[model samples]
Target: MSEVKLVLSYKETIQSKLDERTKELIIHAKNASQNAHAPYSSFHVGAALLLSDGEIVAGANQENAAYPSGLCAERVALFKFGFDKRDRYLVKAAVAVPQIKGENLVPPCGACLQVFAEYRAMQSTPIEIVLVNGSGKVLIAPDIYTFLPFAFTNRSFKYFI
Candidate 1:
C-alpha cells in the first residue's frame, strides 16, 4: 500500500506588493499591536479581521503573569468578532507581529489555528489569511486549510453525536 501526501500552497511577497485593501488590513493589525499588554515576553502580536460587511475588527495580545492564562492576538480578535457580530462572516484575516531587524514570520499558535478552523467551518467560506512578518514580508493563504489541512471538524465526532 502507498501512503498519500498532501501539499498546500500559499503566496509570499513583500508588503508593498499587496493591494490597498490588504495593506490596510495589515496596517490595522500593526496598529493594534501597539495596544498589546505583554509585560513579560515583550513579544506583541495583533490580528485584524475583515467582516463580510466591510468592517475591520482588531485585537492585541494580552499577556498575564499567570503563565497559560494569556491568549493570543488571533483569538482575541476572533472572540470579539464572534460575540459582537455573529451575523457577519469573516472575509479575511491578518496577523501582524512587531517589526524587527530580520524577516521573522510568526504564525499563529495551534490553539488559534483550531479556532480559525472552527470559524471557517461555521462560515462555510474561505477566509483569506494574510501573515505579515517583522520585516514587511507577507504570506497569503487562500484559506485555513493551507495551514491546518487535517484540522478536526464536527464530522470527527459524528459517531458520538
Candidate 2:
C-alpha cells in the first residue's frame, strides 16, 4: 500500500468584500437557519446551494424524535437541487449556523461530503463551499474535496478495471 496526500485550497475573507453571489448565499443561509426544525439539538443550521442554471436552493436542518431520522441542512439543500434539476450542476454551497453567542460556520459532515462528491463527479467540476460564521466572516473553499481529504472516489478503483 502507498500513502498519498491531497491538498485542499480555500480563501478567507470578511463579509464586506464578498461578491454579490457569495453575499446572497450567506444571506440565504442565515435566513434559512430561522426555519430549522431542530427541537432536539437546538442547534439550527442552514444551507444554500447555487446551481449552474443560476437557481438557488436552500434548506434548514430538520430534526426528529427518532434522532437518526434527522437530516442536515446541507443534504436538504443538495437534495432539493437534485429533485428539482437532476441534470443541472451545483456550483457552490454555503452553510451557516446560529448560536446563542452569535453565528458560526460548520463544515458539512462526512455523509454530506460523500453526497457532494457524487454531484461533483457527475458534473466534472468542483463544488465551492462557503462557510460563514455568526460574525458574518466568510471562508470560501473553491472545492469541497479540500474539506474532505482522502475521500473515497471511484477513481481509486480504476486500476481494477
Candidate 3:
C-alpha cells in the first residue's frame, strides 16, 4: 500500500476573479436564485450555464413535497441545456448565492459533480465553473476535473463486459 494525496486548489475571495463573460453569467444565476422553490430547506440555489453561442440559461432549485424528489439548480440548468442544445458545448457555468446568507459559497453535491464530469467528457474541451455569493465571496474551478479527480467517466466502465 502507498500513501496518496489529492490536492484540490481553488480561489476563494470577495472579488471577482473571472472574466467578464463569467461575471455576467453569475449575475443571471443570482437573479434566478430569487425564484427558487425551497420551502423545506430555505436554501435557494441558482445556476447559469454559458453556451458557446454566447447564450446564457439559468435555473433555480425546485424542491418537491417528497424530499427525495428535489432537484438541484446545477442539474436543472445543465440538463435543460443538454436537451435544448445537444450539439453545443458548454463553455462555463456559474452558481450564485448557494449559502443561506452568503457567508460561504456552496459547492455542487456529489451527484451534480458526477453529472458535470460526464458532461464535460462528452465534449473535447473543458467547461469552467464559477461559484459566487451575494456577499462577494467567489470560488472558481478551472474545470470539472478540479473538483472531482479521477471522476467516473465512460472510460471507467469501458472494459466491462
Candidate 4:
C-alpha cells in the first residue's frame, strides 16, 4: 500500500470586493438564509447557484423532526437546480452561507459533498463553490473534488454492472 496525500485548495477574499457575479451570489444566498426552517438547530443555512445561462436559484435549509431527514442548503439548492434544468445549463458557481450571528461559513457536509460530486460527474464540468462566513471571509473552491477527494459515485457499483 502506498501513502496518499491530498491538498484542498480554495481562495479567500472579502465579500464587498468580490466580482459582480460572486457578489450577486452572496446577496441571494444570504436572502435565502432568512427563510430557513431550522427550529432544531437554529443554525439556518442558505445557498445560491449561478447557472451558466445566468439564472440563479436560491435554497434554504429545510429541517424535519427526524434529524436525518433534514437537508442542507447546498444540497437543497443543487437539487432544485437539477429538477428545474435537467441536463441543460451547467452550474458555473455556487455560494453557501449560514445565518448564525458569529459563526464562520464552513464547507458542505459529507452527504452534500457526495451529492455535489455526482452533479459534477453528470455535468462533466466543475462547479465553483463559495463559502461565506460571519467574519467577512469568502472561500472559493474551483470544484467539489478539492474537499471531497475520495468521493464515491455510482461507478462504485461498476463491478455489479
What is the C-alpha lDDT profile of model 2 across 18-122, one tens digit per residue?
989889988998899999999888988999998888888999999999978989999999889888888788889999875633444578899999888878877
Clashes of 4: 1
How does residue 110 of candidate 3 score in lDDT? Answer: 86
Ordering by lDDT: 1, 2, 3, 4
Worst 10 residues of 2 by lDDT: 97-106
- Enumerate residue pairs that collide in model 1: none
> Candidate 3, which segments miss by more than 4 Å at Cα?
98-103
Query: What would the per-residue lDDT of candidate 3 be over residues 1-161, giving only the tens digit for each residue?
Result: 99889877776765556667777888899998988999998888999999998989899999999878989999999899988988788898888874545567788888889998898888968888888876878888878788888888986888684
Better candidate by TM-score, 2 or 3 = 3
Full-model lDDT, candidate 2 = 0.85
Error of 2 at 125 (Å): 0.6
Worst 10 residues of 1 by lDDT: 98-107
Worst 10 residues of 4 by lDDT: 94-103
Query: Local distance difference test, per candidate?
Result: 0.90, 0.85, 0.84, 0.79
Q: Residue pairs in steric clash, candidate 2?
A: 103-134, 104-134
Estimate the TM-score of every prediction: 0.94, 0.90, 0.90, 0.89
Give the Å error, residue 116, model 4.
0.5
Candidate 4 global Cα RMSD: 2.0
